[model samples]
Target: METAVKTTWKIDTAHSEIAFKVKHMMISTVTGYFEDYNAEVNTTKEDFSDAEFSFTAQTASINTKNADRDAHLKSDDFFNTKTYPEMKFTSTSFDGTTLVGDLTIRDVTKKISLEVDFNGVVVDPYGQTKAGFEISGELNRKDFNLTWSAVTEAGKIVVSDKVKLQLNLQFIKS
Candidate 1:
């Protein structure tokens, strides 16, 4: 648990979750999660300032708990998984809390900042050094070229353009 030099940590996928919530039918919220993804963190300081992070999520593995809807999401109407199969993020700065990074979706890459809450580090009962983090951000789906939309009979948008991203991450020292 001591940081004498730079340390590397790998995300514990089994204990971490990456999810998004979007407004549905202009009335309700629908939540979805990525089943496949990985991330790595490297740091030179215990406070985590200047830490480096990289993440990748498999587009085809997205799930909204509905198969038909999930298929439609994988089509060109949404993420266009056939054309761009993965979304990636690479951190440019981490000031111990706020993290600025480049997020690439489809074929477009844009800089984004996410608020990070570090939940401290602990040595688990298994004797592994672990850290927990809660990260949240919002992004306009249209900016990533996910411009598909529809209006219902009552004139409500089927899907909202704003997507809220939430991540609960656990990392184990490596």
Candidate 2:
């Protein structure tokens, strides 16, 4: 007889964050995050190769610390929040520490690969099991049609076409 084991993890929103950075004015960088997001993971074994992850982020939660700027980002020039209210990512493969997935934003879908490092898994004093992971990746914004920008006086685009994504995710076993 064979035994099967599966574990489920729910994202700890308060302890996790998703953020992105892109060049601005060819001299500085701008950073922001989606205020609301949800994700879950399931694994059939202790190793994460057989794991699955899926996440959804609310488009209206764009926050750059500036209300005016955030509102502009939600406009048609950028995410066009009225038409696409959410962004999502679904993992297709998890090979040890590498992850291959598809990310969909503003109605555009692109395949992205990330190098993930499993910080560790621990059992907390409260008897809860938790797993920590850090992932980093870069993607060309233009590839996803996030092409809103303006030429600066210095002859540079106000926003760079490359966007860098970084995620620190902590999940509690449920």
Predicted candidate 1 versus true structure: per-residue lDDT over 1-174, tens digit per residue: 875688999999988999999999978999999999999999977777868999999999999999999999999988899889999999998998899999999999999999999998899999999989999999999999999999999999999999999999999999
- Winner by TM-score: 1
lDDT of 1: 0.94
Off by over 4 Å in 2: 1-3
Residue-pair clashes per candidate: 0, 0
RMSD after Cα superposition, model 1: 2.4
Model 1 spans > 4 angstroms off? 1-4
User: What lDDT score is found at residue 89 in candidate 1?
Assistant: 100
lDDT of each: 0.94, 0.90
